[model samples]
Target: MNTKIEKLEHILTAFYQEKQIPAHLSAATVYSLMAGGKRIRPLLFLELLEGFDVELTPTHYLVAASLEMIHTGSLIHDDLPAMDNDDYRRGKLTNHKQFDEATAILAGDSLFFDPFYVLSNADLPVEKLVKLIQELSFASGSFGMVAGQVLDMDGEGETLSLAQIEQIHRLKTGRLLTFPFVASGIIADKSEIDLEKLREAGEAVGLAFQIRDDILDVTASFEEIGKTPGKDILEEKSTYVALLGLDGAKNQLTEKLSVAKKLLTELGITDRSDIFKMIKQLEVK
Candidate 1:
């Protein structure tokens, strides 16, 4: 892992630990909050912001935390009896299963709201904050990640076509992954052209991440991924790996990364070379 990733973990840990807790909340909520994660989403936000010449203010930290909180919330909800029903996450017993169902739900709910609280407290101007809020709302709510999750649930046991599979992943996985990148550009006040390029990079990288996840579900052992492997196959869930062979799946991911690089080139952001390389590197799965 990169040193930056380690630093980001420290930052999120310290930030979450600093917040005062409500008496009504369960200890499981704090436990879930303390449970470690890869923090890839926040790292994505941080790396994108680093690409810019501007310094990250407290507002940026809030934005990154918002994504992390929302992600942790989603993980909690995903582990509920109604969802994946897993007993463990990140090598620890899941929040809901470890506590009561109600506690789990409330923890997830609390995690969900903290991001908005962080964002609303940003030091940026009112108009910019409003725009940021709008972007976050659309990407995280019914029109974005949530909708994708619903579709993913619906696709279980169905043999979806390649396009259908892509659509499901796009919604279920891509939206949140892309938002941090999109949001970073928004916070940086990048031009429309550059912003669009960033979106292209994010969309491609996000989709690639899902494809890699599908690949990992098959190739990785449970201990490696920290989640049960082959659940997609066990549940008969439609996935890129199910529809296409591994080689074909990687090809598609590579093609998407290519387009993402092209878009970056068009926006003149490709000059950094390594950033584009990092974006493309996700295609290896």
Candidate 2:
């Protein structure tokens, strides 16, 4: 996974460097993009594509880079004062803190659109390219991550039911996570049933991922998680821990992990050990 992520980073760095832009904007964009992260979204996308025996192409790497750009852009925007007001992310100063708020905002806006430019220029059939772009746009747009963010802001400082929390997460975090799986299916030209199964598995893993994140917020130190701890509690935000209690949240995480693993098995994924390992790594600290 480390090697794969490094390779993706190399590709992204080269791509960004090739762009003819002002040094400051380029520096701001590269700073956020090069920040250390798990790169889980693109890793999942590429792994699933390989698992399904899709012939790897340069276009695929572009897709992977685009996913990272979108995810990073969301993080940059999320850390702004108007949003989560976070000061640090991935153990580094937030974009808005490292750069001016205006520059950070533009950097994020640039990332949001840059993926479309990559897709448009990728060497793919027009139909497939259009479909991929549409999927990405929907996942990151008003009906998807944006909607989730809006819901999260509205639900802040309010007591929310488990269903409501799930809705918020499904939109906010789950949608982008699910993108890699869905995009993989499309790239592989999988059957509708297979694609739907991938979607189900992605959704389960996404929820589990968020549950573990909520758990980490309560249990892990800032140094360990690379972000402030207890911000959820401080902001009166409803999370799995708040709604289900610590043990209950762990149980929910376990259940979602099981569901995701089962769906992967049903999809005929052989060598699910890596998936199991990832889930174990997310176990309550």
Candidate 3:
């Protein structure tokens, strides 16, 4: 793991340890949150803050952790039988599989709202905090991820156009992924134009990430990806791979990566190597 990601893990662990009560709900929450993955969202948040030359503070850590909690909550719910019905995530049993159905549901719920508590208690100024909350809510709420999920569920087993697929992913995956950059912009007090540029960069990366995921689903192994591979095919989910052939998908991913890098350049980001390296690492081998 990257040293920065390790630091994020440490911060998240401490926050949970201090705030989580000793109860079943806490246990369920901790179980999923602690189940490790790339921690991409939080890492993006911190990276963008750094890229913008913003000072890192306790509040920034809180915001990053909160983003992770929101992501974990979504994953817990996503893995439930009612959703993807997956048996494993991040190389371990799914939350619903590890615990009872109700427990998993509550765990997801806890993760969903825990971030708000963290944000509300943070010592940031009222205006910035409110903007953060609003951004978070918009990204995770009906017009964003939830909407994407709904569309995904509805589009299952159906042949969707390329634009349709993009729409579903833009809302479902892109919104939350964009949140880190958006939040970083808020914290840095960037101008509206700069924030829009960050958002465009974020959307490009998010699309690339999902396209890479779709490629991995077909090409990578269960052991390699740490979750069930070929589940998209099994579930007949609409994906970049389904809409665009594997080669086409790879091309799309490359295009998005190029767009992301270009957008970062337009933002006058001097040290874009980190962003480039991250995206390159996600490239389909």
Pull out the clashing pairs in model 2: none
- Candidates sorted on lDDT, descending: 2, 3, 1
Clashes of 2: 0
lDDT of 2 at 167: 96
Q: For candidate 3, write residues 1-285 as lDDT tens digits.
A: 287777677776666676546577777888888887888888788877777787667778889888898889999999999999999998999998898999999888878888899889777889999999999998898988899999999999999999999999898899999998788888888899999989998898888888999999999898898899999998998888887789999999999989988887787654632655676787885
Pairs that collide, model 1: none
Give the winner by TM-score: 1 or 3.
3
lDDT score of residue 219 within candidate 3: 94
Please give the CA lDDT of all the candidate structures.
0.76, 0.86, 0.85
Angstrom error at residue 10, model 3: 3.0
TM-score of each: 0.89, 0.95, 0.95
Candidates sorted on TM-score, descending: 2, 3, 1
Model 1, poorest ten-residue lDDT window?
268-277
* lDDT value, candidate 3, whole model: 0.85
The alpha-carbon RMSD values of the candidates against the true structure, listed in the order shown, are: 2.6, 1.6, 1.6
Better of 2 and 3 by lDDT: 2
Among all windows of 10 consecutive residues in model 3, the one with the lowest summed lDDT is 268-277
lDDT of 1 at 59: 63
